[model samples]
Every structure is written in C-alpha cells, then in structure tokens.
Target chain A: MIRALFPVLAILAVWVLLADGALACAVCSGGDDDVKVKDSYVAATIFMSLLPLCVVGGGFLFLRHRYRATPDE
Target chain B: MTSRTTSLRVVTNPRPPVVPSAVLGMLLFLFTELMLFAGLISAHSIARAGALLGWPPPGQPRLPLEETALNTAALLLSGALLIVAQRVFARDKRRTKPWLTASIALGAFFVIFQGVEWVGLIREGLTLTSSTHGGFFYLIIGIHALHAVAALIVLGMNWLRLHRGILAQSTFAAGQVFWYFVVGVWPILYWRVYG
Candidate 1:
C-alpha cells in the first residue's frame, strides 16, 4: 500500500503545482468592473451546479409522492 | 343446527396505467444528462466570470442572439406541436401524422439554422481553439446539437413506426420524453450562452 501511494502522491504534487493557474479567475486577477466579477462567478457557479440537482431530485420526489398518494386499485 | 360451512373468495380491482416504464427510464436518463450540461454550464460561468475582457474575448464574433431566439421559438413550437400530435393520436390517429411531421420539420429547421450560425461564426474566426469563449460555445452547443440530432432520429423512427401501425405507446412516449428534454433544456442554454 505504501508503494502504491508513492505514484498517487507524486501525481497529487504535480496537480497542486499546476492547480493555481487553473483556479485563478480573470475578474479576480485584474479589473475595475461595476459588478464584482468574482462574486458573480461564484454565484453563477453555485446556481448552475444546484439547478440540475433541484430539477432532477424534485421530479423524482414528486413522482414518489404521487405514487404513494395513488390508491390501490 | 348441524355444521356451518364457510367460503373464501379473493377479489381484485384492476389499476389504471401509470406512466410507462420506458418513458420513466428515459426521464431518468435525461436527468443525468441535465447534470452533464449543468457541469458544462458551471464551467462556462466560471470562465465568463474570470474573463478580463468583455466576453466573446476581444474580437470574437458576437453570438447571433436575436436570430437564435427565432430558432428557439421554432423549437418551442415543435414541442407544442408534439403535444398536439399526442392528443390527435388519441382522437384521430390519422391526423396525428401531419402534426408529427410538422414537429419534426421544425426541429430540423432549428438544427439547420444552428449549423448555419456555426458556419457564420467560424467564418468570423471563432473556431473552437480560438479562445475560451469559442471553446465553451462549441462544447456546450455541440453537446446540445448531438442530443438534438439523436432525438430527431428517434422522432423520425417513431414517425415511421406510427405510419406502419407498429409503434408502441411506451416507445412513442419515450421519444416524446427525449424530445421534451431537448426542447426544455434549450432556453436555459440560450440564456446562459447568449444572454
């Protein structure tokens, strides 16, 4: 297990080094803009991510409720 | 009184049909696909937020927002026509064919228009590798186009099967479910990508 972890750790180290460039946002980097671009991005990201779950999960729950409400025939 | 005798009987009531399993299965599949698109949209949101320049990234061709709205209307109308087709299928099976044809035509029109728009954008030097905006544009819309094409093919197949009197209700419903996902998902995409 220790030997197996070595390669994983090496890959993680590489990713850690490269991750900074990948994560940096343009708005946060430089800009005198009206709306805080970083905040907008964060808001948009959260909304987009949650939307699918809400839609899909809500549909499933609704269906289940309906199923239970239905009387045995 | 001598001996008493008893009789046992089992009674069963027939249940009405609920949503067909095929349609439900398709719905589940679409749910997953919705998440897939969500991931793409999230990426776009992050990219657009970070974009230092006005989005479309300095000199990238502006997306034809107004023109695409017309196309979006066409797709929505197609969905409406599909509902009509389903209704007509129940009342007058023969009449449903024309409505189905119309729906398919509208869908194809949307796809073709998108292709035209893509050509225009490419001519304007907005290729996939051009910029983050260009790359995401293609990735998101390209995935949608792929789903639309597949859904169209399924709709076409369903149309053929209907004419032959071999189309099962479950299959027909499944096709409708897929089309609904394609149609329903576009407005969100339009707002995100275009707006």
Candidate 2:
C-alpha cells in the first residue's frame, strides 16, 4: 500500500508547492483595492465548485439509503 | 431431488427501484437545471461585484423590490398549496382538486404579475441591450421565468389528469419536485439580484 501511494503522495506534495502559481485570471483578480470584487470572486468560486458535489452527493446518499431500506424480492 | 430442482430454478422477479422512474428522471433533470442557475447566478455575482459604479449601475431603473416581494409571496404560497394538495391527495385524490386549483391559480398570478413588472421595467429603459445591469436582470430572471412557465404547464397537466381521474402518484410527485425547484430557487435569486 505504501508503494502504491508513493506517486500519489509525491503529486500532492508537488501540487502544494506549486499552489500559489495557480492565480486567478485578470478579470477575476479585479482591482487591488476592491475588496468586494475579490470577495465575490471567492464566494462565487466556492459556490460553483461545491454546489454540484453537494447536490449529486446528497442525491446519491438518499438513493443509497432508500435502496438499503427496500426489502429484497 | 426436489431441493436440487428448487436450487436450479431461476429467479424471475427483479428488485424494484428505490424511486419511481418518473420522479428519478425529474430529479436528474432538476440537478442539471440547478447547475445552470448556479452558473448564471455566479456570473451575475461576479459581474455585480466588478461594477465600478455599484450594482444596478448609476442610471438604470431600480428593480421593483416591493412589488416583486408581493409576487414572491404569491409564488411561495403556491408552493405551500402544492404540498397541501399532495397531502390531500394521499387521503382522497378527489379532495386535492381545490388545493391544486388554488396552487395553479397562485402560480399563474405570479407569472402574470412578473410579466406586468417586466413591461413596466422595459418602459423604464431596462431593455436587454440598454446596459449590463438590464442584461443580467433579464437574462437571469428571464431564464427563471421560462422555467416557471414550464413547471406551471407540467402542474396544469397533472391537475387536469387529477380532474380526469387518471393522475398517477409518480407523475404528481415528479411535477411537485419541479415546481418546488422553481419556487425554492426564487428567494435566492431575489436576494442576489434585488436585495
């Protein structure tokens, strides 16, 4: 298992090291003094990223529960 | 020999679905629709944030916050009535008609009121091409309106089926899910756009 995880761990370490390089685009970065714009970008990014996962994950969990509750024919 | 024969027999019955296919299909569709709205709302947020002169821009006519609030109440009440109708349906499907009719009427009222509001806004120089504020307003709210109309149509059809004594539970459930989505998403839009 450790050997199998070695590449995955290495990739994660590299990703962490290079994280700051993944900066926002010019439009998203907005004006340096405009806190509201920066905040909105962050909020919107988080919302867009998490919404699908929440919805799809919730749906999956509900279905799984229902399926488990159902009696076997 | 009897035990051996029983073991060899094939099981013909399949496990039933956790959710009805119709309801499941509607849920899946709503998921995609939810994502679409999310994207639009996200874009609107970013645009509003980037507006140097502040949201609604300097010269754009203000959104009808009060009037639209009333309309929002009407839409919410319609959703509530639908839940009531569903409950009534469980007892006596026939008894659900009045509640269902009321729900549909309120929903229709919402749409009509929105249309009137749109006309007023357009006359006030909030046309689609006038400004970014106007554009986002129309685009986000217009897409929502389209969804509302479509959901209302679905509910209307289900109501008719109920009237004709042919409505299935699954069908009504599916329509309910869609109508709820339309109703549920509105408050968020109102807050993000109008508030």
Candidate 3:
C-alpha cells in the first residue's frame, strides 16, 4: 500500500510544480496575465498533447486486439 | 551401400500475420510524427493564448480562411478516393488504377494550392523571421507540407507498381498508411492555424 502511494504522491507533487509552466508559451508576446487566458492555454495545451496519443494509442490497441482475435485465419 | 531417394513436396498452407509488418511499422512512425506535431501545436496554443495583442498579432496579414477550407475539402476528398482505390484494387486491379490516379491528382492539387498560398503570404511579408506568428505558421505548416510531399512520392511509386501489374498488397497498404497519416493530421492543423 505504501509503495503504491509513494508513486501517486510523487506524481501529484510534480503536477503541482508544473502547473504554472503549463500556462506559459515560448513565442507569446507577453502581457497576457488574465485568468481566463491562462486557464484556456493550459487546457488547450493538455488537449493537444493528449489528442494525438489517444488517437494513435487507441488505434494500436484496437489493431492488437484484432490481431490476437484472428490468428492464422 | 544402398542408394536413398528423396521426394520434395510444395507447401501451400502457410500462416499469415494478422496485420502486415509494413503497416505496423508505418503506424509506429506516424505515432512519433504525431508527437512532434503535438509539441508544435502545444507551443502554438501557448503563444496564441499568452499574446499581448491577441493571435496573429498587430500589422500581420490575415490568414486565408475560406481558401484553406476549400483546400481542406479537396484533401478529404482525396483521402476518400484513396480508400476507394484500395478497396477496388483487391477486387480488380485494373479498375483501381483510375481511382488511384484521381486520388493522386487531388492530393497533388492540395500541395500545389498550398505552394501558391505560401508564395502569396511571403509576398505579403509573412516569413520565418518576420514574427513569432510568422515563424510558427511557416514551421508547422512547412513540416506538414514536407510530409505530404514525401507521402505523395510514395503513392506515386505505388501507382507505377500498379501500372506494371506488380503492386503487392503490403506495398500498397504501406503507401495508404502514409497517405492516411497526411490526411488525418491536416484537420487539426487547419483548425488551429487557419480557423
């Protein structure tokens, strides 16, 4: 129980630390400190990062399942 | 010593893999490419959101939204045509030729249109070093265009093989996988960059 909890706690701490950086952009012209902009930026970044993974990963998993199901037929 | 006679028989029953190794390899390659695009997109999102004067910035020429929407439709049509070609190829190779040709034509048109659009943008003062907006626009779209060009070459080769009556399913499928990747990635880029 304790060993599993350690990883979860570690992940949570990292997430907290990285939260601020998530709202930052390399090419931004600056001066945008609005709460809405910051929140939307974080959300969009996360969505962009995850969307591709979900698509490609889900496709791979489906293919794997199908491959396993139809063997030597 | 007595002479021994050996008989050889052809084996016709062989087990085939469920998914071709070539297609699987392409999928893995596309996954990595997808990650690269994701990183660029994430940066674009951040830049757009955090900008002081909103996205596209002040004094920059507006992105051609309507023109690109039509281009997007053409690309999607090309994807559909390619699917038809793949399906028909299995049933009749000769019949598949026209579909493949049409698909290639549409895809080439998309690339050509993009080139024209880029020329216009450059003429209008949008370039790599002009601004961050210009930089991201060129970098992201240029990378995608590079992949599209390479995929077109692959598809062209596959078409040549089809003409020679030697287009193997694995080779054709590999070309299709790359084409699909090129097609699949565009809409996201369109929404983010153009829309």
Q: Which stretches of candidate 1 lie over 4 Å from their true place?
A: A1-37, A65-71, B1-17
Model 3 chain B poorest ten-residue lDDT run: B10-19
Q: Total clashing residue pairs per candidate?
A: 1, 0, 0
True contacts kept of each: 0.44, 0.68, 0.51
Candidate 1: Cα lDDT at B72: 100
Give model 3's docking category. acceptable
Error of 3 at B165 (Å): 1.0
Candidate 2 lDDT over A10-64, as tens digits, reads 9999999887633255654454457776787789889999999999899999999
Candidate 1 structure quality by residue, lDDT tens digits, B14-37: 554466788878988998898899
Measured against the true structure, the TM-scores of the candidates, in listed sequence, are 0.78, 0.87, 0.83
Tens digits of per-residue lDDT, candidate 3, B94-145, equal 9999999999999999999999999999999999998888999999999999
Ranking by lDDT: 2, 3, 1
Q: Show pairs that collide, candidate 1.
A: A26-B50
Instruction: Identify the runs in model 2 with alpha carbons over 4 angstroms from their true place.
Output: A1-33, A69-71, B1-16
Best by TM-score: 2
